[model samples]
Target: MKAVMVSAFGGPEVLAVVDLPDPHPAAGQVSITTEAIGVGGLDSLIRSGALANHGAAPGRILGSEVAGTVTEVGEGVDTAWAGRRVWALTGESGGYTEQAVVSAETLVPLPADLSAVDAVTLGSSAMVAHFALRHAHFARGESVLVRGAAGGIGVIAVQLAARAGAGAVAVTTSSAERGARLRKLGATHVLDRAGRGAQDAPAGYDVILDIVAGADLPSFFARLEPNGRMVAVGVMAGTPPADFGMEMVAAFRKSMSFATFSADTVPALEQRAATAELFTAASRGELVAVVHEELPLEQAVVAHQKMEAGEVFGRIVLTPSRR
Candidate 1:
């Protein structure tokens, strides 16, 4: 099997394709012949040593989610899954290879109408968006502001919020072109990456889904309406200052709230169920899987480069079978 590994944690250049022995499934596990792999900002963070303290290290296979067909099942596993197509969360790694092994329990049977590319693109990201909105206690007709709304999670978040009947779905994106695309996905308003157009909201946002957390974090916090909730899901711009939360404390009179969310914290059963729902919605065209482009698996380095450069509009899927 050919796998891309972090030769050394530094830049995209550090990712190298190397030949490795095929991996097999253990008891209660299954092996997949990967068709598509989802590349995410977290993968870049792990590869660049930005998350070193979080257990990232050299020689790691850096991928989290993939979609493919199951070719083998381990002991005590159902034989029916052997030839089934599924989307899987590979935990924290092992997805950047032609074949991946994961616990059978983590598999979400792909909808018959969903392609591998769409499966991987919407799998984890859609679930994250779904849970984040729920965590924010989002209510129908409540205004939503999706910061950094051009990535996989952000794009899906916009649609989900709109579909749930948000009065307004505002997004912070890099350009008019990207924002225009987001509008088509249900964004009622578009703001620049700096959140320039947020001031137009009459009472500020009722819920803010922030994917970029950094120096600008405080500014967005100020845009929250009284009693509003802000959920930070990704630190793509980098982590905010340690005391960034002091803003929330100082604004205590407004009764606003701030929180951080990760899909990891969601129970496995719930995550699988949510993923299934998302896949079904997408299959029925109730949702859209925004794929910026698909590259061969060996181009993992290029995928990381594009993501870090902020040149991608949506998910960049890697087709392992392309090679």
Candidate 2:
């Protein structure tokens, strides 16, 4: 099997496609022949040495989400899943290759209307969005603010909230053009990051799905309703500031809850079920993965470059160029 492997941490240049042994499933596991690979910010972090100590890199396969067909089954696995289309979030890294193994429990069947490309594109982002929104216990007629609303997770979050009966969904993006596009994707309010208008998001939101961190925190925390909740999914803008104490205290006093989500930790059953719901929504034209581009797996370096440069407006998926 050919895969993107990283032996050292540095940059996108570190990811090299090379032949590697195919992974065989252990007991209770299944082997999937990769069809589409999801490229994300975490992949970049792992390649750049940021996640080196996190136990995911160095002489390891580099991918977290995959959509593929079952080619083989291990002991204790149900034979029914063989040849079925599925996607999964692997706890350990190995989604970039031609074939990868995962516990049968992690597999989620792809819907008839959804393609392998779409499944991989949404990957864990949609799952995380669902968990965050559901965990926040949002009610009908409430409003929420979302940062990075044009990105993979934000787009899904906006649609989910809208369908769940939000009074309004306010979203912000660094690119004015992308912000404009988000409006058509169900965003009720689109703020331009170029003009510092994100500062006003606190005024109208009862909850916030934060994908970016740093100075944006102060502005975002101030926008939440008295009992509003904030789910922190990423720190695209960098880490929090030194004086982040105010927001922490505000959250404590107002009974606000701050949380983070990782699909890697999601239960296999829940991942499959949530992914099925998301795919159903996509099939009905309710939720769609805003795919900005598709590149060959060998060009993963270029994909990471685009993501890190903030040039991509939505999810980018990689496909194996060879069988």
Global fold similarity of model 1 (TM-score): 0.97
Best by TM-score: 1
Task: Report RMSD (Å) for each prediction in the order shown.
Answer: 1.3, 2.1
- Model 1 C-alpha lDDT versus the unseen true structure: 0.91
Which 10 successive residues of model 1 have the least lDDT summed? 194-203
Candidate 1, residues 1-323, lDDT tens digits: the string is: 98899999899999999998888899989999999999988888899899999987898888988899999999999989989999999975579999999888889999899999999999899999999999999999999999989998999999999999999999999899998899899999889888776456545999999999998998898989999999999998898878877867988998999999988799999999999999999999999999999999999989989987889988999998543
Q: How many backbone overlaps does candidate 2 show? A: 1
Off by over 4 Å in 1: 198-200
Error of 2 at 79 (Å): 1.2
Which candidate tops lDDT? 1
Local lDDT at 62 for model 2: 85
Model 2's alpha-carbon lDDT is 0.80
